[model samples]
Target: MDKLRTVSDTKRNFYQYHNRPINSIYRRVVEELMVEMHLLSVNVDFRSDPIYYLGVCQSFTQFMNGYTPESDKDSIFRALCQSIDNNPDEYRGKAETMLNFASQKSPQELINWLLSPTDDNGLQDVANHWRYALENPKFKYSRLFAIGLYSFLAKSDAEIVKNEEKFAELITPLTDKLSLPIDKFKKDLELYRSNIEKMTQMLTVLADTLEASKKKRQNN
Candidate 1:
């Protein structure tokens, strides 16, 4: 039997990935948003609400980085329809409404909508409407929606990075994967480390210069 996991379990697992800077920051942002939403009386279920879940993912990605593949629009519409068909009781009206909205727009219009600035109230209104379709009340804060959007994304990205690290560990006969002998791999690693050291020194110099500027301004 498949064991059921709680939201706490999911959170704990995802927290392990926070060493990946982007995902870590994103998770913190999501956690803070969740707290704020609770304060505002918005009942968001990261575990159970599919609309809220996927809606969060969609809008959060846009908010963090306002770019969507041009290729995904049609496929997204199709998937919505399929989900609705599979569970008419839950998704029928919402799916149809989304389809209608999509049908009224040109492909470019849809792309523009996705690319719209996160700060734009109009863009948020559209995201809120999607959440409304799932029977949740309109979100008072736009940031809450972003938390929903990024909750899954942050974890997924972290898992990918973890898997990549694991793959590197399992690549035995490392020469086969690197297409170089072990000695060559060591040589390349040393060169890379030296380059990194040079970059670190440059950054240290920049930091010192900025600190000196701050002190000089204080004296003046």
Candidate 2:
């Protein structure tokens, strides 16, 4: 296959694999992240609270830093431990226990569990959660929450490139079309892309912070 065909095929295959649910029904990570943001909206004004939003970004990046396709049960558990360790004030008590339990699973399994709804409540799935979060009157700032969640996911994608093993795993598959001599160029490009992604994430946060602050001032 040509390079373009290879890229398309790879994406299609991976999407089919990653998007497939271990459970009978499929639940997307993006939807789950939005639901999580809605829950967070109860405590922080993603639209108005600059500091809280920055904290959200920090938390998102930290969590994503620990997670990747290459992540194992132990690494994920350690990441959860570190998060709880660093933010005892936020992640303590019953919440901490639940998170600790959740961390033992692989990333896919963990996501599946997160996207799964309670059996007793019949809460539906991740899509239902996202819809409820957006439509519920209690989540007045849900639009903002969703926007923040999208940013969090984007940042997480960029953060994953920082993982050398994960990055190599990601790029190695694309090498079928290239000559051996171009390997150095591919490596260079990987490093370049990683740096650019990180810088772009930083700029996005700064830009979003400024825009949010401007809107808040105007509303005041």
Candidate 3:
């Protein structure tokens, strides 16, 4: 938080994450950040509060990013599909960045980015990547980022609706993919009425276990 103290609102509001296909979701997240923090992000041009992050900042790097005209994109798409099917987590971000970027663009901008000439042997997976995201655990469990991912998914006719079975299926596979023990995610979501309630429950369990151990040690 201290890092925030030295900065002006303009800089913070205008902070751009320009590394495309890597920080693809940055534009949307930054936009949301500006909206959420709008009370502090003020401007005087119209004597009204500045709407920060209302738009994505697409750079002039269009021609240099993707595959050349002659390169075959077949193998990358196959690999992405296989990796996602065998285990979704392992391929979490393989094609998500451009999907996020394309999703957030306006129609004209979208057309421009799509039609831009390829720089070199661009991975054809660019065409199939979002389709992969549509089929993975990332599509279901990544609700927090669905808005960012949704831009692509929406265009692809993908759905990320709230569903209980999907939620359950998503958490378990995702937990294993990340090598997280299933019990941990379950434990984190527990709610108690108060801190004291949680403390009491923990103390009671700890005391009973400790007492049983004391008896065992004494008997031994």
Displacement of the residue 100 alpha carbon in candidate 2, Å: 0.5
Model 3, 81-170: lDDT tens digits are 232122222233333445455456443343333334222234244434433433343322211222222233334333421343443453
- Compose the digit string of candidate 2's lDDT tens values, residues 25-71: 11232233334443443343222222123334444443344233433
Error of 2 at 76 (Å): 28
Once superposed on the true structure, which residue ranges of model 1 sit more than 4 Å away at CA?
A: 1-8, 17-19, 23-27, 33-50, 66-220
lDDT of 1 by residue, 148-213 (tens): 322322232334223534423333232242232435434443443354366456556867998999
Q: List the residue pairs that clash in candidate 2.
A: none
**Model 2: how far residue 30 lies from native, Å:** 28
Top TM-score: which candidate number?
1
Model 3 spans > 4 angstroms off: 1-32, 35-97, 100-146, 149-157, 160-162, 167-172, 175-220
What TM-score against the true fold does each predicted structure earn?
0.24, 0.22, 0.22
lDDT of 1 at 48: 26
Which pairs of residues clash in candidate 3, taking residues 3 or more apart in a chain or in different chains?
Answer: 66-122, 67-121, 67-122, 68-120, 68-121, 68-122
